[model samples]
Target: MNRISGLPRMLAVAIIGALSITALAQSNPYDKFRNREYSNKGYLSEADELKLAEQVHQELLKQFRLVEDRSLNNYINSLGQRIARRSQRPNLPWRFYVVDDKSINAFATLGGRVYVHTGLLAATRSEAQLASVLGHEIGHIVGRHGLENVKRSQKYGTLAGIATVAGAILGGQTGAGIGELAGNMIAGGYLMKHSRDAEREADFLGLYNLRDAGYNTGGMVEMFEILQRVSQSSPNALGSILASHPPASERAANTRREISEHLRGSDQRGERDSSEFERVKPSAPASSKPPRKVRPRN
Candidate 1:
């Protein structure tokens, strides 16, 4: 074989190195999620997630009329902080707010900002029931479920862009408006179906959070039952909530089993209803007339 010159050999080595780097960069961004810690990866770094959360929180304050009752807001904030401290991404700045809309709905965005509708709060029968709902929404945030959905959507190219842009656009709109838009966007059938596995994971994790927050785990099952009943009586009334989370009877059963197996016979002595939940009722603005019930959009 002819001896290669130093320049040619250097050029060949450089080309090989460049190719290797390109291949590494082109590898799927999701490969890391294949590990058991997948749920943990979808989140932005703790600081980044917190920053985004603050941004989203400000946007939410602008979009929705925040419940003004000081005691009510404080109560919700305390409960949320207590539960959030026990979440996987506890380092992120978490906040909870009550919206003035009279629709049975709740939602969480990319960060830790969560919104509970006045209707949902008014409809809940007990503190445990309220915690169950909040815990589930918290589950979506800590589980980084939305981020996973965004990633999966991105894999499909233009459709993914459309979905993300739509989410961002609708996310900036009013609470009821976003709820309606999200319901339609999800139902349009372009987004990847959330794996049943993910749903099960969220349910289990949410129950864990609820229990840790001193709520009866039975509340989780009760919420499901209530949703099912509502769906049967007035599907359109709960369309937004149902669209985001498709309720399953099996999910209720699974939560019940988890409770019995994991939490049965525990002390449960300190878990009592919060007076704040009892004291706070959904209130309308002082300047506004009597609140009108707004039906969920189809």
Candidate 2:
């Protein structure tokens, strides 16, 4: 009778242990994506993700010259925030900045930080196009792509390289050298090169954000078309964006498919242009300075 009671206790212990292991796996969040295509949650807590993004933001500030025009920055911020309000993580401290760089690039870090280069702004023709770009970047933040990459790197034991660099920046070790390395990784898309699936997910989410925010979803397709034209005519101007993203044509096709299937009436009813965007448009031309080549990394 004692042996039988002991077996029951052992079985209970094994069940508890299995449940504990399952709970731990669930905590990482990405484990659920094995059968699914996308997820918004990453391995890091909200506070820790914000902290990491703050570190990256500081590093980025050191590397890029921000557009000092209050109006331009404000307009971009307002537009980004508008779209961000429709995202999965609506309450994040969403912030947008215009980089003076002439490369047609826009990227989002882990937190709500999104940076748009002047060249990207200039490349777009209408408010919807520009909003589409902002929406896409916001989608990346909503998806927590950067943090997901961080979690993935940690799992593969490769996160230490950048984590150490971030620590050195916070700890003020080696000063500019360490900070610059992190900034370069960011610029080169090494630290934030989200997978193609993540790109598709961002596009999917961005379309909804655009439509929900009362902007035309067709602008997403137009954005891709603009990128395609830029790639063919002035490849150097779009090198960084093209390098890190899926082919513009492919993205355009996918966007078209998504629109046809789920958003058939969206473009017909949404705002496609704005007088304010035209006012801000002239200031968005590429800077005279050559763009810093952002080497793409997978």
Candidate 3:
């Protein structure tokens, strides 16, 4: 009789242990990202992305100085939009900005916002090299990298709570806490961190964008060399830009292999430089001020 009674208690214990394991798995914030397909856009709709982008833009205005020269803005927009038109999401309200900072970096955020530091423009050897950098950034948006990373980060319970605050702000509601969370999310680099696979995918897509848009594919390879050189000489210049990417030599080698194996004719056929690029390049002098650097969360 005692054995039979103990069996019921033992079965109950087994069930309780199973329940505990299930709960722990469910609570794990990163579990969902492991098996996800990042090819498709993440949970946010286009409109929602734009709304979030607008908020982030406001936060950026507080952090960096933007070039206000009409001619410079128009030139970058025209070049960026040309490459953007060849992307998977061509109709996005594509906009580009020249950050008046002397850091060799460029980054993209939600809703087609791309920022290139003055140092990056000053560092390029030709229009093709500049366009290659622009294409790489556009490739990230084409793959919805930023949005997917943001969604993954949102799975953390406390950070998940920030979504409700984000929604409230987007829906025209306001609070100090809501605004603060939104700013912290951007300032903290939550939206900029990407996995190695994502970085590789962007490089692949960027090469295609460069090719399809009539620029020499070799520019992508050259851009990698420039990046590698700067990284070796002045490590701080790249800051967070190269932190999550593969080593520069590896990237350049891969790009060259891709060009030789698949995109053979592209390296030789396209335009290598442009007069317009020369006109706009000199205006982007490196700033005397130090750039704002933020350590990204892993």
Measured by TM-score, the strongest candidate is 3
- For all predicted structures, in order, the TM-scores are 0.66, 0.77, 0.79
The per-prediction CA RMSD against the true structure, in angstroms, equals: 17.3, 14.6, 14.1
Candidate 1's TM-score:
0.66
Candidate 3, residues 210-235, lDDT tens digits: the string is: 99899999998898899899888987
Best by lDDT: 3
Which pairs of residues have clashing backbones in candidate 1? none
Per-residue lDDT tens digits for candidate 2, residues 61-89, read: 66677776767778898898899988877
Question: Per TM-score, what order, best first?
Answer: 3, 2, 1
Question: What is the model-wide C-alpha lDDT for candidate 1?
Answer: 0.62
Comparing 1 with 3 on lDDT, the higher-scoring candidate is 3
Pick out the ten consecutive residues of candidate 2 with the lowest summed lDDT.
27-36
Candidate 1 lDDT by residue in tens digits, 188-223:
532223456665666767777788877777777777
Which residue pairs overlap in candidate 2's backbone? none
On the 0 to 100 scale, the lDDT of residue 40 in model 2 is 45
Q: Candidate 2 at residue 254, lDDT?
A: 75
Clashes per candidate, residues 3 or more apart or on different chains: 0, 0, 0
Ordering by lDDT: 3, 2, 1
